[model samples]
Target: MNFSLQQPLENESVKLVPLKNNDFDALYQVASDKDIWMQHPNKDRWKKEVFQLFFEGAIQSKGAFKIIDKSSNEIVGCTRFYDYQESDKSILIGYTFYATKHWGTGLNPSVKKLMMDYIFQFVNRILLHVGAGNLRSQIAVGRLGATKIAEESVAYYGEASKLNFIYEIKKEDYLSVS
Candidate 1:
C-alpha cells in the first residue's frame, strides 16, 4: 500500500499540498476555533487539546491535505480522503473544514474541482457523508453533482451523535460532467 503518495494539485485560486508536520502550526491556527467546528461531529470548542487530537488523526490518515490560498500563501482549511475500503473500490472525502472568511467565496468549487479531478483519476467512486442538518455542505455536494444514496447516524467527537446524508459520485458520472 503506497499511501505516501505526493500529488500537488492546484487550481487558479487554491493549492493542495500533502499535509506534513511542518503545517501543524498554521493548520492549528485556522482549525482551533470552536466556531469552525460547530456543525462538525468532532467539536473542539476551540480547545488546544482537541485540535491536537484532530491534527494527530489527520497525520495518521494518508490522504489528508492542507488547503492553501495561492495568492496569500495562507492555510485556509483542510480536506481529505479517509475510510478507504479497497475491496469496495471506494473512498470517503469529508472532514472538510474551512475558515468562516472563506465561506461562500467560490473557493469550495475550486477545491472540489481539484479534489474530484484527482480522486477520479484513481478511484471508481467517491463517497461523502455530510451532516444532515448542515445544509451548506449538502448544497455544496449537490453542486458538485453527487447523488444522495442513503442516510444514517454516527457518533462524533466521542459523544455528539449526528445524522448524515450519504452522497456518492461515480467516475463515469464525474467524467460526463467534467
Candidate 2:
C-alpha cells in the first residue's frame, strides 16, 4: 500500500485530522496569537493575510493536519509530513506550530510521538528542518533523539528561504530508544 501522509492519527490527548479549506478559521484562531509565531521563522504569520498564504500551502501539500485537543475538541495547531523520498525511504516532518497555551505542557512531544510512530512504519529515516533561530524547536527535536546533520536555506511554502538546521532520526535508533 502507498504511504498516506494525511491519515487520521490520534492518541489519548490529541487527534490529527487532515487539514481542509474549512479548517482555516479554526486554525487561524489558535495561530493568531503573536507569541506562537514570535520564535518561528515566519514571525508575521499571526497576520491574517500572511497566515492565509500558509494555510493555502498546507492545503496544497495535502500532508498537513489540523491538531485538535481531545478534551476541549478545539483546534490547537498544525503540522505535516512532507518531502517523502521513496527510494531512500526518508521523509520530513515539519512546518509545525502550536498555540502558546499548549506550550510547555508536554504537548509538542506527544504530537511528535504520534507522528513519528505512525510514519516510521513506512520510512526508515525521518528528517526535520528546524529554523536556525528557532531554539525551542531544535531542543524539542533533540529530545526525540534526532541529531542535527547540517544547515541549509529552506524556502518554506509561499515564504522566502531561511537558514534551517537539518536533523535526522534513523529507524534503528528510534526503535532502540523506545
User: What TM-score against the true fold does each predicted structure earn?
Assistant: 0.88, 0.98
Shift of residue 65 alpha carbon in model 2, Å: 0.5
Q: What is the C-alpha lDDT of each candidate?
A: 0.81, 0.93
Return the top candidate by lDDT: 2
Candidate 1 Cα RMSD after full superposition onto the native fold (Å): 2.2
Residue pairs in collision within model 1:
none
**Each candidate: how many clashes?**
0, 0
lDDT of 2 by residue, 135-166 (tens): 99999999989999999999988899999999
lDDT per residue as tens, model 1, 47-154: 877777667767777678999999899999998888777787788887788988999999888998888887676778999989887778889999999999999886
Which residue segments of model 1 deviate by more than 4 Å? 1-6, 155-161
